[model samples]
Target: MRRLYGHDAVDIEVATDTQRSRVADVLLTHPITQRRVAFEVQYAQLSVAEWRDRHESYVQQGIIDVWLWGHTRIRRARSEYALEPYRLDDVQDELRKAGMRVTFINPESSQLAIAVNRFGRTYSLASEREVDLVAFELESIRLSDQGVRSDAIDPFVTAAREREAALRERELEAQEHAEARAAIEAARAKKASARDLERARAAREQFASMPARVDARSGVVRPSVTMPARVLCRQCGKPLDATLAEFGVHLGPCRWEQERLL
Candidate 1:
């Protein structure tokens, strides 16, 4: 620790001024920023509530606390929903919510390992959902207001953010497509309705223009009525007058059907 930061003011198990007696495992004061950082090596199982309480204590005194969990302690936390062979640490999520950083160091190897969440992809195998731990040197650790900031995790964090942005963009595009389709369908329906209304108006005008005609059956003089007219059939070669137009169907046989009628 003295060789890395050139800080001769490193102390072990130091007490800070607070309402409650707060002891930090290892404390080092930054020479330039005058900021103090406390490093806590957690070997035993610690509950989230207890961890939060301790973290809050340091925060009250304006001290940055960095936590390094024992490998077995961290590995014990497993996700219930995720498949076997890969398990997420629920404690990590809680720590993230408080803007805290976490790392795992085995007693045997004494190497630093960072666990990062995977995003923007599908995981088919159970092992794929497992914790992905990247090993980095302790030299990468830097002190920040948020806690110990490391460049080792920067790539993973950036990738996750990019994936989230891409997903949001895709959703927006899909919504736009649905709205456009609805608009096009409404326009088409409106056009068809207008065309039908124009056709009916023209038919009415053609009927009203005809001269008076005699009724074939009763020999009565019938006045021309301003009603819609329709062609009986293509082969019949005549449109129905006002009285017969209401039927809309061919009453008499056309040349094509005359042979069948006989």
Candidate 2:
């Protein structure tokens, strides 16, 4: 298994000294990230307490440990099953707690088989079902050269960061476009205001030029009647300011004119 999957990335029978004691087993290490995996082989009978102690020691050191067992079986009902019992009082409880499972090596087929406990629901007097022992054949166990079981998560993280950057760039561009549009709108409003002021001034100038008239009964010149001023450009409908030197300039020559002659 080590030659086919682990290759040069992993070292066999590596000795690691922890706070409790030294552990010698198959040490799988990722070539790039240097993550470690420990495999422990147990052929002799061990108490449940002792197994838990050894498993917890490696776990405390942040190392993943896989327990391999040979010729270990737990009986359930009338048949003896190779898998660990589902009962809470059994040693299988300790194995499940340690996140480990017992694997059996078949000498005849030269293959690895894992014991699995399954439960079925049936319409009967018993609401709870019986435990069915099943053996699953492990066709292959391939580990990456990088020590990663499958693919690395770094690429997914990198892609997410790139997408976030692109979203921010789009937001910034939208903000710039909005600001430019607002500036254009402000310029238009200012120009329109200036044009209105010019038209009012032109109307006032026209009103001041009217001649005075006399009252027939008082025999006196009547006060000059003031009329509302109108100061529109003759060539165009646009308003103009009487104070400007080019107030009488044709619309075609005006700076504010939009159309041009060919």
Candidate 3:
């Protein structure tokens, strides 16, 4: 502690109160802000209740409480068959649910490690990684109502936001493409309608200019009407069989030839 901070900035086994006092393992006072941070190193298995009691005690005195657990209390996840220390996952989860911090420090290497889930990511099993302790110490000056907050470097939230934005952009592009196709289809349908109308008008004129047909049985001249011609009946104002009408021998009443016009 003295090497990390200055000689006067660190204190050992500081008592919070005179009677029924709670002792801090190591107290570090910031030289500028004068904010106090108490670090408690626990190697033995400590229950959630006992840890909470000690943590709350420091908070009540306006001191930031930082807990560093050894392998017996919290260990890294491993897959190989080897003797490993039992880690208290349930205890850590309960504390985290109450917005308390859970961290680990290797007793031999003194390396600090934090859970990967705290960075807003997940895995099949719980995993952790060693963090830069100097950066964490500098950022620890920022406080919350609980006196201390998790200072893990977070990037997952930013990545998630970027992904959501990209999805929305793609959806918008798809909607625009559908609307463009519909517009093109509507224009094509209008052009086809106009062309059909023009063809119908041309068919009407073609029928009027056709030469008169001669009846074989009566040997009389008559206007010819067929499936490909368009001639209107003077009586019904519909298509008429001109040859039958001229001969006064109507085979059938006149009807419009819609297919020929188109």
Candidate 4:
């Protein structure tokens, strides 16, 4: 299409409002093959006037073959078998007069076997085997399998599109899962940080509540000395039980104060 295969397969600069043949949704041109394949995808039924108008535009634009992918709607309607039958007849007549060749790629087993729609005064002669997009996608396919058949292009492009779409969907799902995990980890980290803060607060409170003794001699202070927790002095950087306070030295002084005393 113009969006994906613009510079590679399609020519966008060649467009105009008056000509109305400006550009197609997808156009694949091979310089060596001298082949220009164009597509007109139809997701819904096209009335008689719209069908003929579009056919003429494709032919005049020097496109090799035209593919009309009829969307599945009203499965059992006559329009399901053929679209704008009368209009197709008129368009074919005009194209034949202009010596233009047209082929129809209808996605039906019966149509494939017959390969022609000779509706009584209602349609033009066109190959009928439509490209089953879904089956063709799910099935293993090769580009070289169809030798110069325009019909093959429809299915090939369809499969390529479906595969690409599925891959993108999976990638999006994986990204979503990764984002979810990051959010969960962030929340967990915050919870753990809160718990650590609570433990720190409780520790500070217990240390403040515990009784301490300061040795006036060594400037060493000891907390409520215990076997394990708080066994180190809160001040003077000395073991609680081994501090000046435990040694009953009342006139302890740090080096800074000792120098002043000297």
Instruction: Please name the candidate that would achieve the greatest TM-score relative to the true structure.
Output: 1
For residues 67-101, what per-residue lDDT tens digits would candidate 3 score against the true structure? 76664555444544422322345556555555445
Ranking by lDDT: 1, 3, 2, 4
Q: Which candidate, 1 or 3, has the higher TM-score?
A: 1
* Deviating ranges (above 4 Å) for candidate 2: 4-6, 18-20, 72-89, 121-139, 143-262
* Between candidates 2 and 4, the lDDT winner: 2
Q: Which ten residues in a row have the lowest lDDT in candidate 1?
A: 120-129
Residue-level error in angstroms, candidate 4, position 62: 18
Residue lDDT tens for model 4, 134-192: 22221121112221233433543344445557779999999999999999999999999
> Which ranges in model 4 have alpha carbons more than 4 Å from their true place?
1-150, 218-262
- In terms of lDDT, which candidate is stronger, 1 or 2? 1
Comparing 1 with 3 on lDDT, the higher-scoring candidate is: 1
> How displaced is residue 3 in candidate 3, in Å?
3.7
What does candidate 2 score in Cα RMSD to the true structure? 19.5
Give the Cα error of residue 53 in candidate 4, in Å. Answer: 26
TM-score of 4: 0.32
TM-score of 1: 0.54
What residue pairs clash in candidate 3, if any at all? none
Error of 3 at 226 (Å): 66
TM-score of each: 0.54, 0.41, 0.43, 0.32
Clashing pairs in 1: 86-130
Q: Native-vs-model 1 lDDT?
A: 0.65
Residue runs of model 1 more than 4 Å from their true location after superposition: 18-20, 76-89, 120-130, 160-262
